[model samples]
Target: MLLKTDLTSEQLLAVIFDYMAKISSESKLDRVLVLMANMGREMIVADRCTVWLIDEAKQELYTTVAHGVKEIRIPAGTGLVGHAIAAGEPIIIEDAYDDPRHNSDNDKKTGYVTKSIITIPFRNNDGQIIGAYQAINKMTEAGKFAPKDMELLSLAASYAGKSLESVMLHQEIVDTQREIIATMGEIGEIRSKETANHVKRVAEYSYVLALGLGLSRHDAEVLRTVSPMHDIGKVAIPDSVLNKPGKLTDEEYEIIKSHTKIGHQLLRGSRRELLSAAAIVAEQHHEKWDGGGYPNGLKGEEIHIFGRITAVADVFDALSAERVYKAAWPLEKIEKLFREERGRHFDPAVVDVFFAELPKLLQIRDELTDKE
Candidate 1:
């Protein structure tokens, strides 16, 4: 660790610029906190640093990234960080034990001694205080924080506040989009008299299957989010054909198959990655592995991987759960069917993944089982 006193003015400015660049490039909230914590620890030469954010909804101060700690949450107005937030200023305690505001519970829990502390309140671009940066046990001979140390932390906090706000806003938008998609998917399911849990189970099953098939965690999560919309086209389906209790006539069957094209057309306009992926899943989930399926009759590898994975997940749920028109098939029967249709109805590799991860898929089904 480089001490603040060791750096000349030019070197200090360069370090600050480097940190700013790194922080600016990151959009994830957790990664941004880690970068800010590291910047504070390095610039102040402290043994540990923590970035605490005020969760207004919970009225708590929480930190996911902290040195030598898993995750800790406290009341909004507790401890040194709380005091700094409450006072809307910086707090420099030469001896943590001597200060009435310092809390020793964390040190006791972690079996780590606390000696010196400096906390600075950070604000968003709107100039509203949002969180605080706290650095503990400055690595000096005296083990105390100085005025210069406070100045260094304050500089880091300024950049951190803005970056945190930006990432938080991005996360909020993503959450809202997910909620809308989920609701729309539920509407599509409800139109055909199916429960919303159908989509939920399919999403979870798709995630498990995706990971089991060696897809990256990010890609798997994206698939989970978009898989619910696979039947969004059902919203445009007529109740007579969609909810028919008896076997459908050939003409009515054709109308049912058109839902795929309808769903794809609904979502294909969006350039967003999630929506675009949903479009592919919506249009191709019914396509068979042997080129005998509907919409485009896309055969084998021509079917998008997203569609193929969802096909397995969708059929698994559809077969295992009770529907308005049919009783839920027994697990033994479903497994037997999957084995028989391995290469004809489904991708052979996906069917293999289905049996391989069957336990996890069953667990998900049990967890999100229909309410009846």
Candidate 2:
């Protein structure tokens, strides 16, 4: 076996760390896989590769690559991939057909032959097997891979394992953040008539609108979770103002409006991106495009972009909902208000995006309607 001496072990570790950092900060699963796939191909001299992640709960393996192949899930002890995971070790099969561990049925379905295979299990720092990373068909100068080649492949797999662990940690942090935001939203909902489902719908609506308005997915996600805080200030309002059957008295209305300021103050000090977004929603959701609404009456482009977007979402959702003071308006009536208020009470461009997927918005509302 001939070796390429472009990078020393120290250099390889540095490159692997760089890849791990890139994967750790990334949220999109596709981009993460693409980066890792390129790393695998360049770091190891391989041809025609596929990486499978193990789902132990489902006893399955899934592919993130779109190489004319979907994922294949076999029993834990069935195939070479499964065996590698079960034994928590790497498996190098020079001739897959001759090996008893080979599962040939998957290739028949995909109409691709597997000549050679390498499956390595990736374990986290805690010693739990998170997934398996596999690379198939080493394009050799000769007809086969040699012992030294297998050794290098093993080293590359070790780096890949560390990268996979970093991804898992990143995912865990994201899931935890989502749970916290949900709990906070639910708590705020209890202070009013809003249900958890209502909060969820508004969050989804905000996400769709932000994405349509060309916001990055990260920004969209932050706004999705934060938009629910628009009415979090209502938690501080008196029930006399909150549950008024008729329209609020001027005094009551002033008290009710103070919730926006209260919510803004409550969320303002947080260093978190979501809380910062929530603060914007709280402070400016009531602000008018023409400089008329809210505590500060911030006008036009002076309002934070997030604030403008959330203002539309918050009002649209409130109008469509059945509240203490009023019944739910018809979809047509809400649509008319959205159209009429364009650039006066709401951002016209955001409203356009909201209307573009109006059918889906109605469907979501119907799906998430409070059951009383």
- Residue 324 displacement in candidate 2 (angstroms): 8.1
Q: Compose the digit string of candidate 1's lDDT tens values, residues 260-353.
A: 9999999998877788898999999999999989899899999988999999999999999886578989999999999999889899999999
TM-scores for every candidate against the unseen true structure: 0.90, 0.80
The alpha-carbon lDDT assigned to residue 231 of candidate 2 equals: 79
Residue 192 of candidate 2: its Cα lDDT?
75
lDDT of 2 by residue, 171-230 (tens): 667667667767777777877767887788888888888898999988998888787777
- Please give the lDDT score at residue 239 for candidate 1: 95
lDDT of 2: 0.76
lDDT of 2 at 161: 61
- lDDT score, residue 278, model 2? 84
Q: What residue runs in model 2 are displaced by over 4 Å at the alpha carbon? A: 1-30, 42-48, 52-66, 71-78, 125-129, 140-144, 238-240, 322-325, 356-360, 366-372
The prediction achieving the highest lDDT against the true structure is 1
